[model samples]
Target: MTLYLLIYFIIIMGAVVAVISKKLINSAIMLALLSIGVSILLFAYNAPWAAVFELSVCAGLITVLFVSAVSLVKHDEENIKENRVKYVLLPLLLIGFIISASIIVPEYFSKLQIFSTYNTQKEEPIGKLIWLYRGVDIIGQLTLLASSVFVIKHIFFKRKEADNGGKI
Candidate 1:
């Protein structure tokens, strides 16, 4: 609806402005807010699964990564002026792509309501839906988490001890 579109536009503009601002930490927080906006739009469009995925993966995981990176690198108080446009360009493009796909792809998937709306009985709970229908996706997510941990340990945490010849 028009109301949804208006709200989406406002949230997106807020995201862009936040990314363009001078603070890196603020930009990361805004990126999380932008992900929440996408989640809202997903839920509004009747894709609760996609909404949960966005909230868990993009908003949760990526924001944690940003915060870890920020903490690892101490904040500098110096105001280093750079081109503001560079920071927001990629995120803006990604948002535009997502918005376009959300609008256009639905036309092809108009008949998908048949599959999405299927429920065997009222006895089934949400966890049953997740485990029965989406178990493989959950396993894949765990694999990704394991891989991320491997990367952090090998790349970020590993340190080599120095060796020097004693004979001079």
Candidate 2:
């Protein structure tokens, strides 16, 4: 229980820091931290495959893409106007929503228990489940990763073209 709470705290703090960060790189790093926290939580919940996927795709791949994208963009900090009040209030609002959901969501789920169905069959091994039952999900994840790579490559190509005065 204490470990779960600690992970949750890390996730919340990471999210808040990501949202409030002034620099894009810092935000991307915090987002990776958030994904790591989530991956840990999934592992704690006995979902190793999900945890691995979250760590690899979200924390590793997406963070790299975000950092690369942010690096490619020219920052004109002096010309950018930020509303500080929004950043200050957003985390507070998020905390309030989380608190309310914690209070309300359990009761709602408890009520739903009456209508829920349980699978009493023995669980398949993770390897069989992944390759046999969840082949489509695996393919989808691969497709998403491939598409993101292609998109990033396309962005780099365009930036290179612009840098070379459209000579490509």
Candidate 3:
């Protein structure tokens, strides 16, 4: 639908703007916008609960977390230097792996009878749909929550230790 396209366009544009922004705070705001766009798109697709989660967790909590991180983390020259190599390598490796998978997987998958034989026509209630049909999603969300909590705790703990002159 036209509405879906428009909402998707807004989400993508917001994501691009967020990634390209120079200021961390600006990027966080843009990310929040992107998240809101996704929530709207989800609502348009008749997934109100998913939209709510997207708005609350991705748009609200994640944006607040980003703002907190940007404000808390001191951007020193040494920190930048130490992080530069690790960040560059990680993305490069990830992109290379994605390109490899995209090129290799489709051709191989086409020959496989299993992919061609999988059932496509199925429906279930929303509760059963998420819990039974999409269990991995629940796992993934839990993983995300745990990682976020870990990162926030680590940052504050390090800050506390630094404040104590590395005593604690």
What's each prediction's TM-score? Answer: 0.57, 0.78, 0.58
Q: Write the per-residue lDDT of candidate 3 for residues 1-168, one digit (tens) a residue.
A: 898879988987787667655567888999999999999988988889999999999999999988987887747423553544554465567579869998999888877856576667785778998889999999999999899899979876645666878886
lDDT of 3 at 63: 96
Per-residue CA lDDT of candidate 2, range 61-157, in tens? 9999899888878476435899889998997898899899999999999999989889899988989987999899988989998998999798766
Residue 32 displacement (Å), model 2: 1.1
lDDT of 3: 0.82
Candidate 3 regions off by >4 Å?
A: 74-122, 130-166
Q: Pairs clashing in candidate 3?
A: none
lDDT of all predictions: 0.78, 0.91, 0.82
Report the Cα RMSD per candidate: 6.3, 3.5, 7.0
Alpha carbon lDDT at 100, candidate 3: 97
Error of 2 at 96 (Å): 3.4
Ten contiguous residues minimizing lDDT sum, candidate 1: 159-168
What lDDT score is found at residue 57 in candidate 2? 94
Q: Which candidate order results from sorting by TM-score in descending order?
A: 2, 3, 1
Candidate 3: Cα lDDT at 21: 59
| TM-score: the better of candidates 2 and 3 | 2
